[model samples]
Target: MYINPEQLSSYAAKFINLLIDYSPKLISAFLVLFVGLYAIKFINRIIRKIMEKRNLDPTLTKFLADILLWALRILLFVTFISNLGIETSSFVAILGAMGLAVGLSLQGSLSNFAGGMLIIVFKPFKVGDTIEAQGVIATVLEIQIFVTKMLTGNNQTVFVPNGALSNGTIINYSMQGERRADLTFSVSYDSDIKKAKDILLEVLNKNPKVLQKPAPEVFVKNLSASSVDFAVRPWAKNANYGAVFSETLEDCKTALDQAGISVQPFTLQK
Candidate 1:
C-alpha cells in the first residue's frame, strides 16, 4: 500500500492551478455585473432628465423609464450569470411563458396601454383640458396608461378607459379660441321675428364678454309647428363659455319679456 509522495503532491498542485484559473473568470463576471447595473442606472437617469426637459407627462415618463431600466438590468444580470457558468436559458424560457400568460390576461389593459402611449406621443389632450369624450364632459385630471381621469363640473372624478377614449370621438372644446354659443328659446309664431332678432342683438351688443371680432348674429333658424325658432350665435372666449351661457339665457328672457314676446308652454296630451 505504499504510495508515491511526489504523485500526491503533484495532484495537490493541480488542484491549486484549477482554482487559480477559475478565480479571474469569477471576478470578471462580477465586474461585468456591477458595470452593467451602473450603466443601466446612468442611462435611465439621462433618459428621465431628457423626458422632463421635453415636458413629457410625468407619470408616463417615470413608468416607461423604470420598466426600461429594470428590463435592461435583468438582461445584463442574466448574461453575467451565464458568464459565471450558470445555466440561464431555462430561466429566460420560463419568464417568456409567464409573459405570454400575463399578456393574455391583460388584453384589455394592453389596449389601454397602447392607446395611452399613442396619446402621450401625439398629445391629443392633457391635464386641465376640458374635453368631451364618450358622451361625458369634464376637465382632464390625469392621463393614466389604462384610463384618463377627469373632474366634472360638480367636482366628481370620472375615469374613462384609454381604449374606449382613443376609439371614440374626443371633442376638445378648449381647442378653439372662441366658441359660438347656441341658445334656443322659441317664441310664439305671432311674435315678430324682426323684433326678437333686434332684442337678441341688443343684448349681445351690451355684453362685454362676447367677442367683437365676430359680431353676434341673430336670425330665424327654423319655422316650428307652434313657435318661431330663432338661433343666436354669439362668439365668446372659451373660459367665458359657462358664465356667458347662463347670463345670455337670462338676458334673452329679459329681452323677450321687455319686447312683449310670448313663450308658449308645452301642452300635455290628456
Candidate 2:
C-alpha cells in the first residue's frame, strides 16, 4: 500500500515521543542496578574490615563474607529485574530445583563442610599437634575447609575427611604436657621378678629425660603361655617420649639377657 508523506511524518513523530516516554524507565533501571551493585560492594568491604579487625582467619572470613555479599547482590538483582516488570517466581523456582539436586549430589561434601565449621569452633587439635586418630598417628599440618592434613610418623602426608575425623576417636598426644613411657618385655617364666624390677628402676633413674615426680611403676603384669610379661610405666616430658620409650625398652631387654634371663620364643605360624 502506498502512504502519503504527511501521514508517514505523523507516525514518525509519534514513535519518537514514545521512545522519549520509555527512556526514563530504562535509565532509572540502569542507575538503580549500578547503585545497588556499588552499595553491595561497599558493604562487603565493610564486613571484610570488621572481620580483619577481629583477627579471624583470612580464608574463612573472605569465604563467609563473600557468600553474604552475593546473597545481598542477588536480592538487589531480583528487585531490579522486578522494577522492569520481570516476574521472579519462575527464576526462584529454577534456583530451588537446582539447589535441591546439587544438595543431594553433594551430601557428603556438605557434611564435611559442616564438620570443618565444628572443628574451627571447638579446636580439639590445632595445626602442628601430634595426634592419634582412628589408629592413624600423625602430626596435624593444616585444618582446611573440608579436610584436615597430616604428616604421618613415617613422613607420609595424609588427608582425612573432616566429617570422619569429627565423628571418630581423636587422641591428641600434644594436649598432655607429659606422657607415660610405656614398654612391655617378655622373659622366660623362670626369670627373677625382683631383679627385673630393680633393673628397670635403675634404667629409669639413669635416664635424665625421665620425670622423677611421677615415680615410675614396674610390674609383672601377665604370665603368658610362653613367657612372663612386665608392664613398665614411666613418666616423662612429651618431647622426650619417643626417645625414652625406645631406649628404655632396648636396655631392659639387654640387661635382662645379660643377667641370664632369655626372652621366651613363641611361633604362632606353622
Candidate 3:
C-alpha cells in the first residue's frame, strides 16, 4: 500500500497527544502503586509484630499477612487502571462474578478455611495438645488451613477436617496442665473394702508421677454379684497421665495380691 506522509504525521501527532493527556495520571498511578506497596509492607510488619506479641500461631500470622497483601494489591491495581481513564466498575463487577463462581465451587473448602480461622483465633487446641475430637483421640502435629494433622495413640496419622473438628466437641486433655486418671479395679466381693481402698491410695501416693496437691482418692464404686469395684482417681501432670495410669494399675494389683486380696474380673450386668 502506498503511505501518505500527511496521514502518517497526523497519526503520530494523535499518539503523542494521547500520551501527553495521560502522562500525569500515569505518573500518579505509578506513584500510588509504589507507595501503596510500601505501606502494605509496613502494615503487615506491624500486624505480625502485634500478633507475635499476642502469642498468635506463626502459621496463622503468615497466612493472614499474605492474604492482606494480595487483597491490598488487587485494590491498588483497580485504582491504577481507573487512573489510566479505564472504566473500573465493569472490571470490579467481573471480578466479583468470578469470585462468586469460585466460592460456590469451593463451598466445602471455604467452610473448612473459615473453621480453621476460628480455631487459630480462638485456640480451642494447639500443636502438641492431646485432643479428642470426632471420636478420635490424638496429639495435634500441625494445624493447616483446611485440616489438622494428628498422631493417634496407635501411631496412625489422621487428618481431621477443620470444619468438623471446630464444630464438634473437642476435649483438650492438655489444656489444664494436669489430668486425672480414672482407674477402676475389681476385687472379689469377699475382700475387705477399707483394706482395698487403703492399698489403692498407697499405690498412687508412692508413684512419683502422681500430683500431691490434688490428693489421690480411692472409693468403692460398685458392688456386683462376684466383685467389688474401686474407683481410684489420681492427678498427674498431663505429660505423665499415661505413665501414671498404667503404673498405678499394676502397682495396685500387686499390692492387693500381696495382701491376699484376690483381684477378680469385672462381672457384666445383664
Q: Indicate which candidate wins on TM-score.
A: 3
In candidate 2 the C-alpha lDDT for residue 194 amounts to 82
> Best to worst by TM-score, what's the order?
3, 1, 2
User: Candidate 2 residues 1-270, lDDT tens each?
Assistant: 899999999999999998898778778878899999899989999999999999986556755786788799889988887666567898889879998999999999988888877877787887778998866899988877789889997899999988888888899888877889766767776778788778877888888988888988788878887787777888888789888888787777788778887766541110
Which residue pairs overlap in candidate 3's backbone? Answer: none
Off by over 4 Å in 1: 1-45, 55-73, 76-86, 266-270
- Relative to the true structure, how large is the alpha-carbon lDDT of every model? 0.84, 0.81, 0.88
- lDDT (Cα, tens digit) per residue for candidate 3, span 160-208: 9999999999999999999998878889878898988988889888899
**Candidate 1: residue 241 Cα off by (Å):** 0.7
Which one wins by TM-score: 1 or 3?
Answer: 3
Give the per-residue lDDT of model 1 (tens digit) for 38-76.
899899999999999998788678768977987898889
Clashes of 3: 0
- Which window of 10 residues has the lowest lDDT sum in candidate 3? 261-270
| RMSD, candidate 1, Å | 7.0
Q: By how many angstroms RMSD does model 2 differ from the true structure?
A: 6.1
Each model's Cα RMSD: 7.0, 6.1, 4.6
* Candidate 2 local distance difference test against the native: 0.81
Q: Give the local distance difference test score of model 3.
A: 0.88
In candidate 3, stretches whose alpha carbon ends up further than 4 angstroms from where it belongs are 1-46, 54-60, 76-87, 267-270
